[model samples]
Target chain A: MSLILAAESLAEIINSYAECDASSVAIAAVIHVALIGAFFGLPAGIFIWAERKVSARIQDRLGPTRVGGRFGWLQAVADGAKLVQKEDLCPKDADKPLFRIAPYVVVIASFAAFMFLPFTDGWSAVSLDVGMFLLFAMLSLEVIGVILAGYASGSKWALFGGMREAAQMVSYEIPMSICALIPIVMAGTLNLNEVIHYQSADWIGVIPPFLHWNVFHPVAGPAFIVYFVCATASCKRAPFDLAEAESELVAGFLTEYSGMRWSFFFLAEYASMFLVSAVAAILFLGGWDDGFGIVRALKGNSTNVLDPGVIAGNLLGAGVLMLKASKLVLIQIWVRWTLPRLRIDQVMTTCLKYLLPMSCALFLAAVVYPMALVLGTGRPQILPLSNDVSAEAEMSTSSEVEVERAAADGEVT
Target chain B: MTIDQYLFALFALLTCGGAISVVICQNVVRMAFSLIISLASISALFFLLSADFVGATQLMVYVGGTIVLLIFGVMLTSSSALLQIRTSPAEGFLAAGIGVLFLSVFSFTVWSVDWDRNEAKLAGVTAVDVPPQDYNEASSGNTVRPLAMSFVGLRPDKAGKAPGYLLPFEIVSVHLLVVLIGAAYLARTKRRVSAES
Candidate 1:
């Protein structure tokens, strides 16, 4: 825990000192990007192992059960070794620059998106007021790189994969953005912290507080469901993953890539899947609030709403949010193994015809629901900062001492 | 001669110089790239002026949005064989000479401007006058709300300046809608007729 908090404090101090100049600011950006890269890189390795096990379970067979352990936890590392050792090949007809550059482009875009992301209130490396918009915009930049990767690859299979990605990510972005806006409108702010807190607000209902959580609001309820579906598509999983319908296109846009380069895409995929889920978790689910109302009931001697412990609180919040996000990502992996990919046209039609309209309707209902509350109660009945998980982020730059102490502990280790 | 003033001068020079080069560039992709450099320098200038929100928006829209889209169009239309559209050398030299003359005149204007930073201190903008609150010290305080309010019909913050851009904002929104539709229609892939037949 101290190790994690140390990184948090280091990031803050590093951010404060270096953010004034292009050179040092860029250095700070690199640190943030490095952490993002590590998060995605490590998780992608684990997901590969998870996918094999999940796929095997779906097929009613043991997957690498004899390797590493009963669950074959080391299976991905072993496969990675095999992939790295295997021949790296590019066809004679392939476009060398695009083929070599594709994976890095994808990885870079996703990493850039992290700079604007708020882990806790004030935990962001770069917090623009339009942080959410900027985050989405950066995420959208990934599609262009993917499209270029496809077009420049000079192969029919690669071209098809790229086109499918261009079509899928671009189309799905609409519904996803609309669904994202549902919470945005409902919260009345595009500031991610404000939106997350607005979603965290505890309702006026009596009885079970857990029941009065996000699951109970008619508008938030539907928006939650809509955002989930759109998120699944945005992450390009299972039914929406027509871009990589492997049986048909032979690994989609990734057909030419191999070794470490190939793995970056998967890492990006899983991390982004987790990222979108975390966004949903922040915007709809009570972020780190534990919707069960347990953690809040436990805080001692602090209406300060923010404190020295708040960074830990947010780290804990992010951890809880991460758990929920990983659960969703796991469900995606589960679905991928169980369900077959949709046809390319069907994927497009589903996005434009169905998901888009449903999200728009939910957005309208959520918007009117809040307005209606104000009319009925003479004052808005919306829950206050209870949902704003980052509101709990205590900006106590006091965590530096703990870092030195943690360094001592690590040296002892 | 503060660092802000120095940085502002560097970025302003970069923006104007890059933008002029963009106008002269024959290759669409190169032009797009030049425009991006110009937009970026302008955004840097905005940041130096303390317009943080505006600077970020400029980056998000101009550098990342407009320039990317422009490059995408160029990429789509341009085959590898024709990396550039060549203008006559005579034309190029003439344009260069004219551009240099224009640049000199622009530079002269740039050297003479006495852009004031409100030394007299305008009253009624209480938010700016108030001594740094603890939270304000922590941030530059989230600029999203102030920018948004300025876009709508409100003057709670900059009461002295013209009220929110109720009309211009709406017009821009409508203009954006039209541009979006026109771009999609124009850029849509059309079925090519067989020219040989």
Candidate 2:
């Protein structure tokens, strides 16, 4: 579709020609990781300027009115240069190796979150069925990096900040996941595209189902609300932003960081903030689809701009997903400015006391709601893609088949 | 040998080598780092074997969650101590000998496996395209659903084959709940109990 594909194929060819799978896979992984790195680095550059401008405006000030252009757009770029020029500091008493490595841990954990995230249908690097769970898993890991960063800094302030974060993040993760699960269960599948498609062509009252499309399905309606709240918390947006609440802990766990190392944590924070919003979009808001059904309608048409051949439908799907994810990311940034930060104990109380039970109830309700759909409708409401998988259960359990088949084959080793 | 086989060997060697290094390394921090490598390589091995879900779980839970906890604990406990806690040379040698013997026996059993026709079919997709996702949670095809369902007291996947781990799942959950509570209580600040000193 673009010059990128040509360049990518060329690189893949070069990568595949490497002497072994170890080297080949390693090369490919490096390229993939480099692209992600570029994504993080470039975005941080632009978003930093945007954040400064946005935050300044909220506080009624002229943000960055000096350097780059009419609006101080070059301020972030200038800041990057300054950070690069600054000396890297690790206290004499700081754990040497851990201090050196903590930033990379944060970066890696955030990057790994991309693994199970689907850009489009069947277009993921690894199309995992448990993409939902894996996203949570990787994201939960960000706490570890934060804690380690705090601890390895060897300052009393750093230790306090890190320990507090370790407790807060781990506690919040439970309620956050449980809340997020509400929408997922409503969708019946954890595959990002499937969840979005459920919203893509929703029918409504007035215009014979064509004009009155709604993304909000009854089952997923409340769940989306829940999902947004959970996503905000998961991203550590305002009201839940205790990890580095500036006034309280003197930037909390980020107190000791400066220069490029400090920037890594900020980059990770924003990237993860973007990532959570994107997940919310995919799960609850009907990813990539404009809810007009136009994209879905034009998907298979050959001459349509939406269908440019060679997995164009999938590409469009990816476009829709990314578009939605981007929009949601902007919303997260907006929310960050509008709300005041919550106190630490209050944050934990809101999660453990209030959100936790509500999420559990929603999960239970969603699970049985599907069963009711089956019974009331005289068929499963959700279209069964393949009945063979279900019928196979009647034939024999899968393990029996596996054991019998494995026993039959001579080259299983 | 196929690239797959070589990849398997490479990852296996990494896992074993890293694990051994973990045991041998006297520096506690380095030992934790080596454990991370070993566990990570084992996850890679799981991926190679087409256990993608399990591999991811390994990364998420073991490497990400547990390793972080262990490292944090290590750092906290080693606050005033040197970077490492050294064992006596005699103790180390005895442990190494026991470990070597156990590894040899394990390897011998593994090498002796009869990879029959059925067995080959069961786990033969070394580099195949992802299998069509059929919704047979009762079957091993869908690892995520069955695993989750198994935690909630069902063994649809292994219903006919082996004992359902329903009891174990409940026990683990309760155990986790208790541990969390206990940890919180233990870590909470309290007034000094003694004025005698």
Candidate 3:
């Protein structure tokens, strides 16, 4: 969806420079790369700052007060500066090449995953049809980077951390994918854009737009909870974070990492966290839609106009999507501060023994649900219920007109 | 060059470079990392071919799942200091020569096929001038729905020309279940001989 829009925009811009020539292509490519860098780099810095602040507030303390003024908003920047200047040390016995390259691998995987995400309708960097699958795939590659980082460290602690992450991530992925499928089943499409579009439809001609979100559906409700749990674990956030249990593995896969290299791992973590949450928002929550049709109204009926309302609506919708994702990220942070990290065995058990079966059941129920609805009500879908509501409104309006006509006739008589 | 051509060249370089790196790298971990690069670039190649679903599946199943497991196995069994398992130059050269020979044969077989003729026929076009509608026909439609439908015993793509995947999907799922159980069984720690015993 966004690719089509991007192609159109590129074509329009390129028209002034030349046709779809090399120079125009080069300009477009550079711009796209810059945008991707901004999206990736900006989130890493903000989320790190947000995490510190949130954790500090939870612990009843100010996280950063001295860096760049009042709230220490530039704390991440200061930290980045410090990290950059820090010595890039390598252990004598460590695999030099793989150790140096591993962080970049992780960064690239996370960056690639972000490209598939749609901030607003028709605004993704590379709106491929298999957006969700591609995101999961790229994210899955992050594990390899971690494993390499751990193995390259030549330390028992790092190796343990890397191995734990591999097992945890691979196991958590099964349940996560299944849980994500529940909404996909309901939406009848894998396209993330269409998934959110499906959620905007009302239920039974009476349910409001907010109620229509997949998180509110009987089957999808549990699936959302399960998905979040799996997502948290996959992101290596607290509780499931045996990979970096400070008390046990001494920072896990990150045990040997220092300075910017260490921060790269965290960057990947925060980015993946945002990615999964954004996916959840798109899959279960009403993605960029405000749920009250405000955006639609702002967009108006015009097709060609790029007026303020249309632009504002898109910006607002993107803001809403990001806000929802951030809320989820905050909850993840809150959970991290509150919950105790689980043991490795417990983490595996949680995913495979509990969440896996639960997600499968949710998938089954979600599939059976609409079919059962069709059987019971003879209705093919619960939605387009907004259409039914409008029809009912129309019928009532006609009845009122008939009553008015009868009253006039009686008065004449 | 066109943007698509540049992208193809880039990805092709990445895929081949990664493949060569995997063979050249000594350490098991580095080899795994190189293999990951190769697999990921192959998926990008799949995307260039416009098999979006296949590309993603390749990434998810091969790059993400299998490679992680492979690395896990390597980690569990090998000591970090001894992970570098080097081969002799003569052996390396022999393997490289065999690999080159196989590649040449494969490329020759691939180039022997008349892909352009087949594609033109599929698009119902003669000469190189493709109308927009015909060009659209050349690229496959969104595969997600058709893929899903096929899993449920519906082949809407080519109608009766192709068989549905429902039974195969079921079989694969069942096989995976059995494999999962077997892995769990294999991985479960044997009850320690009682200290008393």
- Please, what are the lDDT tens digits per residue for candidate 2 over residues B104-162? 99999888887686577865643233233343222223466556555655444443233
List the lowest-lDDT window of 10 residues for candidate 3 chain B: B127-136
Residue A141, candidate 1: alpha-carbon lDDT: 62
Worst 10 residues of 3 chain A by lDDT: A1-10
| Model 3 TM | 0.87
Q: Alpha carbon lDDT of residue B166, candidate 3?
A: 88
The clash numbers for all candidates, in the given order, read: 6, 13, 0
Model 3, span A161-226: residue lDDT tens = 888887788889889999988887666556677677666543344555777788888888889999
| TM-scores for chain A over all candidates | 0.80, 0.79, 0.89
Cα lDDT, model 2, residue A192: 59
lDDT (0-100) at residue A197 of candidate 3? 64
Docking class of 1: incorrect
Any runs in candidate 1 off by more than 4 Å, and if so which? A1-34, A82-99, A120-122, A201-215, A301-312, A376-413, B1-52, B59-68, B75-84, B88-93, B117-141, B180-197
- Per model, how much of the real contact set is kept? 0.11, 0.20, 0.44
| TM-scores for every candidate against the unseen true structure | 0.78, 0.78, 0.87
Residue-level lDDT of model 3, residues B1-197, one tens digit each, is 66567777888999999989888888777788888888887887776676677888998999888888888778667765577778999998999899999999999999999999898787663223311111122353256655665687644444323457889999999999999999989998777689548
Worst 10-residue lDDT window for candidate 2 chain A reads A1-10
